[model samples]
Target: MGFDPSRPDIHLGHVVGLRKLRQLQDLGHQLILIVGDWTAQIGDPSGRSATRPMLTHEEVMENAQSYLRQFFKVVDRDRAQVVYQSEWFGKFSLADVIGLTGRFTVAQFLERDDFAKRFAEHRPIAITELLYPLLQAYDSVAIQSDVEFGGTDQMFNLLVGRELQEMMGQRAQQCFLMPILVGTDGVQKMSKSLDNYVGVEEAPDDMFGKIMSLPDEFIVSYFEYLTDAPVEGQTVNPMDLKKRLAEEITEVFHDQQAAAAARDRFERVVQQRSLPDDMPVVSLSTVSGPRWSNALVSAGLVSSVSDGKRMINQGAVELFPPSGQSLKITEDGRFEAPEPGTAVKVGRRRFASFQE
Candidate 1:
């Protein structure tokens, strides 16, 4: 299996394949994990509207370093042989790269959905993107893989690997394509860049809350792909099923005790419309100014300053000042940081108790 370091974390979307790989390992298959350190710079063009930004080798390696612990949650670390592309690709000369590119034509790459559409609309397609599938294909050749695992979106790349392997006189590997998990938005596939992903390494309460916020329709699929527990039937309320889904999936990444606590925390803050007993605390110790945006980011309430503004403007945020009047963000109005002991509510799930 090949995973690039384009992102830092392996999310629940990836768990589907990782789980299957574990089953294979139990059947005594040697799992070779290929970390695409070199390919991350070129960026995978799958499901993209335009060319993706390249990453520095340093940045790619840093993200790759963080992948193992989350990866080991499903696949055994000791049972797997982890390899980086730099080990092989670093030794390639200009002549070698030219040779590798010669094996495929531009027409072959344009057959991909993203590439085809971009070409029809006269959008820019980078030469590096055309090389992405081939580099990924070479990984299979280098590792001599017998079976490859990837998401359905990667069908084109996986097929290229099989073809590349056969051209090198090796047996063509079987491609195992898994379903792509939909994001919490319910419209798009789960991706880290979209901010709709429920990261496996997120806090129990946070993970539980994101799952709860999913559309009712996604409840059943989440159960089928993410957890072993079975959902009862359509007779049950969808909201209730979503909660059960949240608890079951949460229990896999965390203990039942933590999952239960998170469920209770969700109910208290969202259903009951009250502050969580253990609401996260935002320390005012190092804050440079009385910027509300700074507080939101520091407490992990919002992702960034722009996100904080969006939530506030959407009326999803409220500040319960010590004076008992709720303060709201207003254009051309004072939106200073809350006083110490202020309680901030961002949407229904996130709460921050600002403290000096």
Candidate 2:
């Protein structure tokens, strides 16, 4: 199992492969987690239309530390061996590099979809990009991996590893590819950069809410990839199925008690249109004006006044008065102050009430 420290957090998308690693570990196979400290500098070009930005060694190391911390949440740290590729690549001499390169040709490199696309489009392919698959192949050779796990996009690189391993007189390793998890948008692949990712570290309520918000069509896939819950023969409402999926996933990251509590909280606050028992209260003593955006920021509902304003314009900002109907704040300029007991709801999971 190899992963690059390109980001600091692990999302549900990465969990698919991690779960497979866990299954293998339980079957008495040794799990080797290879942190691509060296390969990340070159950046894997697979599934990319343009060159990826390079990360400094410091940034890569920092992300690697974060990756290990979060990785242990799903994988048993005691049974896994963690290694950095720099241990071998840093010691490679010019002759070693030449020897490695001599085993492959430019024609074979260009056969890669990423390189072929660039060549056809008259795009410049970096020499380092060409070397990425080779280095990745050498990783398996260095570790003498018997089996490698990755996403479908990495099939080419995984095959390269097998080829390189056989060239070095080692038995060819088997490749296991996991399906790409769809993002929250229900369209593209799940990614943090796209802000459509549900991180494994999110609060239980947040995790529950995000899963519940997914398109009805994704319930089955979410259950199949993220949980061991059965959905084969029984027919259930999509909403109920989604709820079950959300609770199952939340329980895996959290606990059964937390997952149940989150579900109850979501039902009370969202489905029932009632306030949460533990909703945060904000003191409005120093705040002036009926500026809903500023009040939202003061309550810590939005990150900034500008974000509050954007939410307001997007019709996501709502004011629920204690005795009256909930009012949606549409316009941005000054307005009358919200009643003392009014609770502000922002997006799906955040809520806060004003106090004197």
Candidate 3:
């Protein structure tokens, strides 16, 4: 019962609303996740400073597929009812639009904070854009949702749904607004456009590293919402809390074995410690490619080639020879087979093995 289906990656802001929905699901309420395909065309302007770019049907369909994949990781897909609103909204006629428009007044629409701010600053608010909230409201009426959930920034749209339900002679749905999760930048909300989000489907170590790299200010919110830790009345250190948060979130997407390994890897590399014997491993074929740096990047052991080189120069990249001997990698690149179980290390963080 919300908008913004463009990117499927759910950040902490989304986790908040989904958590509430999960709670209701636990309480035996009817919970449905409306894809909002119909509404996405108009793009919700609830928290936006400028108009959002509209997506084509093909692009929207592709992104929607990715969205559902990551969505089920957190929510119980077995008990969940997933639906696309395009069936109803996409078929609405001119009479339907006019009839729905009669439900609210322009004065009320202009009264929204984002719209008012944009209006005061002489920003362009598109005519079609104004109907977004009403369309979202219609979603609630169509589904007969008992409650609609959204972020604090989405208060206006959530209220619209509530008002629409009441006007349609149906019971008003309660608006549950969760707070936005500040992004890794510590200033803006976690967003794909800002490139600050940690995609849920990221590899185990990648997820772990991203979580560990967050600024100190974001620890509390991360702990309170992202992790399963109970933070109600407990006094906790930010460092310990982030570590726990990282572990819990990692375990959700990865197996416990991998989560434990990622924790150990992060500790050894970032905390200047030593790697545990059972740390996770990545397999690389000797004939798959050339050069250790390129191999490591291909295996996702490093963020990029530049990052791999930086780590190598800093004495972070280590090569294990066939006879179980470990040596530092050099710029004069050599392509050779490693011993039976030889491995390569990038910053004591990422590991890869040479296999025939």
Candidate 4:
């Protein structure tokens, strides 16, 4: 399928679609991605209201520079062809645009739920917006893509390609729509704009912690979609299952060593109620007596200072000294690291063990 690889940061939501691409690649099928540098200008009309804010040429170029990095984390990129849609669509003649549009009717465009919803509520729908799906379909004809993959929300646009392929005297591309993963809120689709996404570039510890915070109901679905782990008919507890799911995903982006360390820390912090014997040590040149929350953030144990406060409030941040005595750090005051092998917990799932 003509998928957009122009976005800079790939997130877990994209991993759902990439899984299908990986499957095809492993089967020795050709995989080509049309980085929608062109369609993105008009914006994809699948899920948005109004027109998307267009990217500048410089912005598009920058995103394309690193766009393929995370993709190989899931698929064999050496077997894939990555092209920019700008190569074809950038030079499309006015007559070419007209011919493509003439292939589809106004009724067909109006039937799409995104357009239908907007039209029903009198939201502005540009005529140019009607051309987005057609151009995406045209991509299939241009490249003669054998199979296309997209999220279920994009079924209409994916079908548009199938229709165009048959009309243009080429074999219709088989469309595979993968299931969508709900965001951390467990309600809406995961999106970076929603601030509910886990970026591919996120630290393993942070990613592990975020996954652990998901609702118990999402564990099985996540295991099914995101990781290579098998969750079919296992009678294990949901929380334990989620930990395994998180570990597999973390292993993909980070080294197996890091994933193991994060898992060990998670178990130590939450399950055993003990500190990790081999926790990472970060050196501070000077000690001004920074707050415990600040120390946790500096040690990469938490996402934010506010998260630090929440951890302490929940009694998850524990400090222990070499004397084997555990200390609780509360919001009202800070605790000193009394000796080597001191431990810090930012939450039940994330802990930092330190020695000065």
Candidate 5:
């Protein structure tokens, strides 16, 4: 259970592997969660088209602390032994590094898909990147782990660990690969970099909405990976299935009451086209003659004016006038002062009222 602290948050994609770790823990196996503090500086080259920026020691430690907090959300902390890879790597000397690197060859490193593609394309593969898998392999040997779990993309690295363990006269460890959870886009793997991830630490309403926004086709896989719910030999409407999936996942990170309240808020505010009772009211300095995109930014509904413009272009922004009929902001256009009690709806879950 080696997890790279490349980011500060753990998303549903990471949960797929954590769930397997939990299953192993339940079976009375000792779970070692290795925080890749040493490897984070080199970065894991798996599934990357470009060189990943290295993190500072401070950044890596900060991210590791955040990761541990979120990781325990699904895993039992008492049964899991968390360690930093620096425990061993920091003790390595120049001679030790030379000996470790000598065990593997350039040909062996290039055999990985990421490395092979870079080599064939004549891309600059950093020497540090080549050492990533080797260092990760040494982790397994140092811990003397019996089994390693990771996503399918990590198969190469996990296999390297098994080989290194056997090379050290220890039994080869078993590698268990989990299917990558698709993002909300239903295309790329769920990742925070792509902004398509549903973080375990997200607000209850936000988590619920992100799950609900997932494509209907993903309901089955979401059920199989993220929740304890049964998916086999069951037939249900895709919408109904998606709702159940959302509720089930929401309950895992949050309690059942919070999940129910979030579902109710989503139905009342989104599916039923009614405003939330506690929707935050944002006051604008000048409510009149403001660009819809700017208003959305001012109200904290969207991250930026460009994001607000994109949402408007996608017909996801609407203006609900207190007196006149509600209107969708179809174009990136400005509006005259909205009615005194007007409210703006952005996407499926966010709402803000405009006031002077």
Candidate 6:
């Protein structure tokens, strides 16, 4: 399979292809991985709305190294052969590139969905971007691959590989395409750039919560793509199914114990309206200027002061004073500490306690 490490990590979307490759590997097929160190500079245009920003050689290499480590989490390392585009492409002359480009036509390239849309919208399609698929097609030739695995969005690039191999007098490779997994947003495909992705390397608690946060309609799809769990034809409630889906997926990447702990934490903190047992203890003075947003930031509940402020305005922040009447952090700009024993809850999962 030809892989361009456009991003550093493997999101669940990329796992679809990796899982298939592992299945094939288990069936005694030899795996040849072609890393797109050179082609990444051009950037693959598949499923892109606008042109992708080109990567420097240094950035591409760093991403490629990170990709192989994550790639092995699903695929076996001992059975795979790794080749880089720089191996042959570096040796190719301008005449060779011109000859390679000669075999394909502009009209043929325009047939791709992303290119067609860009053309219709009169978008600026970079000339280097046009070279992406052709470069990828040449990877199949370099490796002389028997089968190439990719997402359904990569149909055009994979087909180009088959044709390019035939033109080069090599056997055409089989193109195996898998369904793309949707992100937590339940709209776009899972992508690290989109920030809706649940990464394979995420902490168990974070991964579980991210999965649970998805729209209920996406539960079955997550189960289908990320786990071997059977959910089809089951009439379970969507909420229960969602938790099952989250736990199943969380267990695959983490241990069953970790998954269970994450589920329990979610139940206690989110569903039961109870503070977490492990909630951090901080001084009331940690708020410095008594800034509620800064307090959340210091507690590591939110990414930034602005996000903390937004959470407060959205009524996601509350202080449980000793009087048992919870006071909501309605004012984002400032906050007043009620009592020494007051407990702070931010959003649905994060909690902290104020000490004297």
Please give, for residues 1-356, the per-residue lDDT of candidate 6 as tens digits. 87888788888888878888888899999998889999888888888878878889999999999999988888899999999999999999999989999999999999988999999999988988889899999999988888988889999999999999999999999998899888899898888888899898898888889999899887877777777778856678888888888898888788999999999998887888777777778876666645778878876778899998899889999889866888888887656665887788877767788887
> What TM-score would each prediction reach against the true structure?
0.91, 0.94, 0.78, 0.79, 0.95, 0.92
The window of 10 residues in a row where model 4 has the poorest summed lDDT is 281-290
Weakest lDDT window of 10 consecutive positions for candidate 1 = 328-337
Q: RMSD, model 3, all Cα superposed?
A: 4.8
Candidate 3 vs candidate 6: the lDDT winner is: 6
Ten contiguous residues with the weakest lDDT in model 3: 279-288
Across residues 1-356, which tens digit of lDDT does each residue of candidate 5 receive?
88889888999999999998898899998999999999998899998877889899889899999999999999999999999999999999999999989988899889899889989999888988988999999999999988888899999999999988988899999999999999999999999889899999999999999999999888888998988888755566787778778889899999999999998998888789998888788776644236878878878899888998999999999888888889989987665667767888998888888876
Write the residue-wise lDDT of candidate 2 on 175-259 in tens digits. Answer: 9989999998899999988889999999999999998989988888888888887885457778788888889999999999999
Backbone clash total for model 1 is: 0
Q: What is the lDDT of candidate 3?
A: 0.76
Error of 1 at 213 (Å): 0.8
Top TM-score hit: 5
RMSD of 5: 1.8
Candidate 6, residue 51: the lDDT equals: 81
What tens digits encode model 3's per-residue C-alpha lDDT throughout 118-157?
Answer: 9999999998789888888888888898878888888888
Residue 311 accuracy (lDDT) in model 6: 94
Poorly placed runs, candidate 4 (over 4 Å): 232-234, 270-356
lDDT for model 2 comes to 0.89
- Candidate 1 collision pairs: none
The clash count of every prediction, one per candidate, is 0, 0, 1, 0, 0, 0
Report lDDT (Cα) of residue 353, candidate 1.
87
Q: Give the local distance difference test score of model 6.
A: 0.86
